[model samples]
Target: MPAVVETYQKIKDLRDKDKHEKQKDYQSAVETFEEQAGALYEKLREKEQAVEQFNDTLSHGSVQAHAFVQHRQYIEHLDSALDDLQPSVQQARLKMEHARHVLTDAYVEVKKYEKLIDMKEEEHMQWMKHEEHRHMDELSMNQYMKFFNR
Candidate 1:
């Protein structure tokens, strides 16, 4: 194969590898979304349970001091967890968005690379023809040199 053809093939192979890495990162973003959403959902459930338990204790006409104390602590925990989750959810959303963008860009890049490879292959064919012409000229030169020597 000509040098140009070889270089084009090598470039195409590297593009494939890059595409694979992007896909892996996109997969990881999906997993992160799942993890963030799952944890947030569980925390919301805990918050609801805390509020209900606290209301029930009050309605019974007794302080239930120990239960109230524990419920209050749980409420605080739920609030704090929710606060932390907000920023992480936003970050995950951005990561997913960027991953999607990269995937789209990769698709476009594949087309561009295909065009480039085709062009390079055609140019290589032209180069091969030139090389063949040079080789024939060398053969004639060798014959002339032999005649002169004789």
Candidate 2:
């Protein structure tokens, strides 16, 4: 029983380590997703600022045909860039979700191992108590026989 308990303790330790590693992986995934989202937001902001600047310039005077064409092209380009970024952002979010699920599984596994260890320890304690009671009974019997024979 002791050996079995020791083996279970080792397994519990390994599970704990695995849980920590999974937690780290989930945290890294979260950070990566945040960074990607931040970058995409910054890019969109820059594009908006550029559009605002172009509109300001246009308002200051009569717009030339070439400037109108340039503005249309920039808008088209911004639209395409946003379209491209949307998929990447979605992919990052999915990865973060997957990492979260994996972390949850790892945590459950660690808890299961911990529960097993607790049960085994409880069993071991009960066995020890039973053995101690048996020893006391034997000592009492020996003393009784000694007194009777004397």
Candidate 3:
């Protein structure tokens, strides 16, 4: 029974480790998405600032028409890049959710194994108690018989 409990404990430990790894994977996915999204936002901010600056210069009659065209083109390119990254961000979020589900399943598995071990340990304790009672009864009966024979 102890051996059985031990085996279950080992199984639970393995499940726990697997769950931890899955959690790490989920966290990593989240971090990666955050990094990507942050970078895109930063780029968008820079582009917006550049556009504003260019507009200010144009208003002051200090910028060339060709330079304004180039800046507009760059802003359009940034917008397209942001559009491309939206899908990637969604995919990363989905991946993280999947990993979270996997981790939850692993946690459930570990709990199940631990519960089995606990049940087995309780059974062992009951069995030991029953055996001890039987042993005491036998000893008492032996003494009674000896006393009667005397």
Number of the top TM-score candidate: 2
Tell me how candidate 3 scores on lDDT: 0.87
Candidates 2 and 3 compared: the better one by TM-score is 2
Q: How many clashes does each candidate structure show, in the order listed?
A: 0, 0, 0
**Per-candidate alpha-carbon RMSD to the true structure:** 7.6, 2.3, 2.7
Candidate lDDT (C-alpha), each:
0.85, 0.89, 0.87
Q: Write the per-residue lDDT of candidate 1 for residues 32-119, one digit (tens) a residue.
A: 9879988888999889987987788788888867877887887998899999998898899799889979977876776687888888
Position 118, candidate 2: lDDT: 87
Cα error of candidate 1 at position 44, Å: 1.1
Please provide, for model 2 over 57-113, each residue's C-alpha lDDT reduced to its tens digit, 9 standing for 90 to 100: 878988889988988898888878888888888898999999999989988988888
lDDT of 2: 0.89
**lDDT, model 3, position 103:** 82
Q: What is residue 86's positional error in candidate 1, in angstroms?
A: 1.8
Model 2 vs. true fold: TM = 0.83
Could you tell me how far off, in angstroms, the CA of residue 141 lies in candidate 1 after the best superposition? 33
Estimate the overall C-alpha local distance difference test score of candidate 1: 0.85
Residue 143, candidate 3: C-alpha displacement in angstroms: 2.0
